[model samples]
Target: MIDGLDPEYLDACPAPNLAAMAQRGFRVNGNGMTPSVTNVNNVSLVTGSYPETHGITSNYLLDRQLGEEFYMESAEFLRAETMFQRATACGLRSLLVTAKDKLRRLLSDGATVSISSEDPPGWVVSGVGEPPPIYSLEVNRWVLDAGRYAMSQEPFDLVYLTTTDYAMHTYAPNDPESARHVTLLDEGLGAVLEQAPGARMLVTADHGMSDKTRMLHLPAELGRYGISARAIPVIKDRYVVHHSNLGGSIYVHLDESSDLNAALDTLRNLDGVEDAVSGEEAAARFHLMQERVGDIFVLADPSTVFGDPSEVAMPAGLRSHGSAHETTVPIFGCGPGLDTSTAARFRQNLDVGRYVFEDVLPPRPDGLLS
Candidate 1:
């Protein structure tokens, strides 16, 4: 699910932390698109589609064509349905939490969700009858304890954590700080592994990070074409664009309405555009859009990226997934029911979550499957 972690990176890994996991579990070679923003990539993992079909191209969504201006950050927006909800309808319990609150919402509708944005809240509980997935704002000791409890609880089916994502965002993925963060989270994961040794466990990053010195200005590029990109100034380094008034994915909204090819041509032709293609191209190569993402996409070369760095200040000496830069990430798993077949074939981020104990998530039940 990362770009640069090719065979070369693997050859250099003399450490025991990840190589041992690779030997025991499995490893794959794949490339996440440039602008490998988390929300879009995570949604792709769950829904098995590029942003066009999944409809979450970025954390912040804006569509001028239909007069739609709102936080398209909720997981509920996943093609108006999500895999987490689908899993519950089929009788599996699910737990989701992430700094990307939107993913939790989309994937945990019918299932139980414990989520937080800036913090993982400690005091939210509703387990009996169905309840809107739990959302908390602060990270505390309770979350750690509850995570342990969930790991041991037989009835618990799925559990997700976002604390690491926040830390990775604050600290570069290659940094020692990020490794320390992974260690802390690993303790909790190890607890789960020990308790549910029979259960399937898969670990992966939403996307990898490439250090960036310049954040490419997306709106300014769009503005040059006389299109005002409204969502440019979002605090994070991600951006979203689409047409207003549509139930379709972002690509449909953008392609059908705007001179997308022309817009893309403008984007591709730009001096900074390292690489450009439709989200379709990204989907095919990255295994991203089973549904759709966009007809066009741009994966900036190291020289150019996809945000207005001037608009927001990146953490001091921290740059990971949010830039338009390119980076590589790996997926790890060793659990029950996993297919040991050809583990070396590459896969995208979402493919990691697809099978629980070697069982492919049942086909989505919501009528949207049509």
Candidate 2:
């Protein structure tokens, strides 16, 4: 899975391999889970379920009871079984390679082999040479190269490779760096397919990306009306350089004295605020886990993001995501078992996982579905 590969990026870059695969098989626009952030949508793709079932609502969350904040990167937090776990139960070996260590920790359950570019194993570094820094574009190429080397050394029934969105966050679709990034990705994909000619490959992204011109601190905005609230940006993570911990969606926890209806009304009228709804309504509308989110959900317009206004200054040419605007991604499939007719029905990122788990892989021995 590509972290932030959208149709616009593909159109801006030259990707002969990807284009050929799509022409031979299928390529279609698919929807990703909203508040289109990494952790939420990655879990959705691996589990073939929505956040309501998989239980990942954001990259970061606040423990209201404990009054602490943490990154939501634990596999134990997942409420649904993943494709790797199912592959293991079916007596098959699975390989997982990702550009971020957070993803390795979050989705490594039941995989026969797991590696991340962030902290690659000694063997990977020895085989693929030293990987570039995670913040650089070359790190993504190193990840694919490492995955290819590992696959060549051993056999696996299932494989999953995911990359970071550093390039997408740092460069616009038309930027030269964006073209180079996509070209590297396409070349890496071609190598993987060449290594396993008979393998049925499915390619998709966790979310798209967009350019932002403004940033808003919801808590500060609400404070102007004498309302007390804590706004948590859902896209907050260790990779602050990629997005500055800013995004287009935020979870607002109101103080006991604040009126929910009044706060919503105030937020709805704020400039750059796209939508404001109660947590319950947001959960139902976006298929999120209600308890995992805040009391209120706020969405920013396409050109705006949510962050600490005091701590984060809006950078020039800032590109980020985490809104309805980033929900559309490209889904491509190729190989013998991937039927064009079946691919036609794919409308969401989770459908790729559904197809792999339910149709391509053998059914569970216990006859139970995930």
Who wins the TM-score comparison? 2
TM-score of 2: 0.98
Tens digits of lDDT, candidate 2, 1-370: 9999978999889999999888888889989999899999999989989999999999999889899988999897899999999999899999999999999999999999999988889998899998899999888888889889999989999999999999999999899999999999999999999999999999999999999999888898899999999988899998999999989999999999999999999999999999999999999999999999999999989999998868889888899999889999999999986657767768999898888877767888888867
Question: Looking at model 1, which ten-residue stretch has the lowest summed lDDT?
Answer: 240-249
For each of the candidates, the C-alpha root-mean-square deviation to the true structure, in angstroms, is 7.2, 1.1
Q: Please, what are the lDDT tens digits per residue for candidate 1 over residues 201-261?
A: 6666555544444455655666778654332221232212110111101232242446766
Clashing pairs in 2: none
The lDDT for every candidate, in the order shown, is 0.48, 0.92
**In candidate 1, residue 207 scores what lDDT?**
53
